[model samples]
Target: MTILIPAMTQAENHPVSLTDDRGKTIELAQPATRPAAISTFGADVSVALGRQPVAITTFGLQGVPAYLGPEMEKIPSLGPRHQPNLEQLSRIAPDLVFAIRRYTEKDGPQIEAIAPMVAMDLITLQDSLDAVALAGDALGRPQQAREINQRFKARLDSLAARSPGNRTVAILTSGGETPFVYYDHFLTASLLERLHFDNVGGSPPNPESGIPLGYRISLEALLALNPDVILLLPSNRQRGFTVNPVWPYLQAVKNDQVFEVGQHWKESAGPIARSLVLDDIERLLLPDDTPLKTSSR
Candidate 1:
């Protein structure tokens, strides 16, 4: 923690007590009225929870994706995650700062100089939902967060109830030249697990690194698994699959089962993003014989 962080407490001191994913507790004079999120993910959550922080991180601010809508572009941005402009940040007069452990671990002390911080585990599926709750608490809107989470879970429950039950799928991302299969604990994969879709992600979350791992499976490895469906993120078009030498022979490739997705898959935790993910799962992965479930719970 940074030396700049204010000494926090309740009663005679800061009025509200909040605990982050790292188990670090912070006491706020009151619920934050003007917060600054440290990343695009945090910014999206703020809007989803109806708070819409005044400041967001610099990197990827433009790439916040269409799902976040126009408000994303309206907010001012801090410097990169590792180093933000403290003088500029102070000018914003933010009451609170929200960040993930990835950023907090490296820059917590420096960021603390601007405002007290709430750093949480937001890299995976479970963390994302937790982040929504934290944002709600920070903004004094816990009920809204609860309602949103319940709705998200209910939608998943509906999907699970109507799932085909015995199908395998693989997620591929266009963030790189060759699509890499995401690990089981990644946001989208976790949603797939909830929907009862058999996942082919051979990797899992790495405990030491505190990061969910992804592997760019070779053509031979992909051929061996031959998952029933291949979800393509960042790009929905599947014609690019032809670049791989054995792409034409893959089952998902041949059967027209390759589905394209948007930023929601990448941002599995955002309220709106997760909702879209469920929508896509129902539209693309479910069996034609299965009755479609309404997106609304």
Candidate 2:
């Protein structure tokens, strides 16, 4: 890869100043104590750093992450991550705000009016690592963030070393007749690819947004791909595709390789979520081996 990011092993008294994913310099007099998380990554990183956000965006239908424990539920919710309740957020009066670039870009000025928003690009594996570092610095826990990243990298290397031979795989979502197949650049897909799983969706044609991270596929199209394994990240439990005549004929379905994974597989940019993802992969794919525990969990 590129140059290894130097560890910020100690907290600094100097003003916390860093460029965000939006390429804007966010400077704080000290460090943020009461931060509002408009993105789940923000909430995820904050909790991992031993600090709870004053308020946080919802984590799908599950509300605050259950993995983060029940205490998170007590924290005020800003509704949905994409369109958080700005009025509610302003009332909380947080000192800083962590947000997703794509989701909050339009509301950047509005968010900044209340508190300085550090918009993060939480798409790829590298983005996740960078966001953790940025959040660590912002929250005055740079060292913890650095350690988290190091542990994550180590885990990836370990998983890659143990991954089975280049088996073609696909991360599919939606329970409907037409499933949305993830491109390799998506966080979970990237993790799988790192473990030597060849992603059938490869990369998207339009690189800028990766907007439609997954392309909706017909049963005919899925059959043409016929991946060896299918990791089903359903939006809900109702799987309409299972009843189709073509479903049973697929290689993964016939061989009993169609595994239904949790929401962590979808929103997997944060340290805790990603670590849990590694656990799931190990449990699902490397079942015979004993699960190795790590500080990340």
Candidate 3:
């Protein structure tokens, strides 16, 4: 017979006990409950752990994906991860808040006053997997979290096996006057890297201010790259709802190699979204004799 015990919490000034990546003891004020995920990645972790957050940071106009098991829509919107709404957050009265350390550090005192806040470090794929596990443990749902991690790894392996080598790919943000090129470290670039595609160049120099969080490139720069495949992320604007003006000119566009990525797949970090991203990339990278529609726009 198996026995279940309540999750552990750290005593006052006694160091909240948790294990790090290296299996070192990590101390915090208490176990996480009623968590407010300050980033999409953190929200993914919370959802995987079976604890529905009271509030979550928003992504864009499309909002959270419908397939996040339907409980997502009920959570109160706390605005963007980069810029959280303190007023809404205060009303939620979260017991713990999980966010990227870089973004949360500045508002530490303010957030801590409402509740104990912990900064999660999720840089690489490994880091993300570990963070998920940690979140599961904190939320008393370790088994479910491990299963999700295992499934994701298995899917990644399958994608790697089916992928063709030496395909040059580029990720672009569209719907504006000028399309933008994404850097290697961005989430979309990370997804492409998993499928063994090569990003054409390094990050763009000094992307425009307040143009989302990516590097911008001119049409001339995109043509210079000469990629075999192009993945376009649409904006939440009127122009995005209609046709793409620059689609007819590019090499990939001319060759019918352009593919449209949905907002949920490109933006969210949860299991379902990641799986969709993997499937989309597989369809593009694998050689199928059937000629399908080029643009989903």
Candidate 1 off by > 4 Å: 1-14, 58-62, 79-87, 174-178, 203-210, 235-242, 287-297
Please give each candidate's TM-score.
Answer: 0.84, 0.91, 0.76
lDDT of each: 0.73, 0.83, 0.65
Candidate 1 per-residue lDDT, tens place, 209-248, comes to 5475587777678889989888887644454444878888
What's the candidate order when arranged by decreasing TM-score? 2, 1, 3
What local lDDT does model 3 show for residue 199? Answer: 75
Off by over 4 Å in 3: 1-30, 121-123, 201-214, 238-247, 287-297
Q: How many residue pairs clash in each candidate?
A: 2, 0, 1
Model 2 residue 181 distance off true place after TM-score fit, in angstroms: 0.7
Candidate 3 C-alpha lDDT tens digits along 1-297: 011223453232333445543333444554566888787766777776667888888777666656565788888988877778888999999877777655676776787788666565454455566677666656656678789989988877666665664777787775766666766555557667766778764543443221234566766676778788887776775433124555466677778887877765454455556666777777766765423423321
Cα displacement (angstroms), candidate 2, residue 257, comes to 0.8
Instruction: Rank the candidate models, highest lDDT first.
Output: 2, 1, 3
Q: Between candidates 2 and 3, name the one with more favorable lDDT.
A: 2
**1-297 in candidate 2: lDDT tens per residue?**
121223553345547777887678877876788989997788888899987899999967767768777888899999998889999999999989999889997888999999998888788898899888888888888788999999999989887766764588988888687888899889999898887789998797776765668788888788898999999884755777778899989999999998988777888888999999999988887646534434332
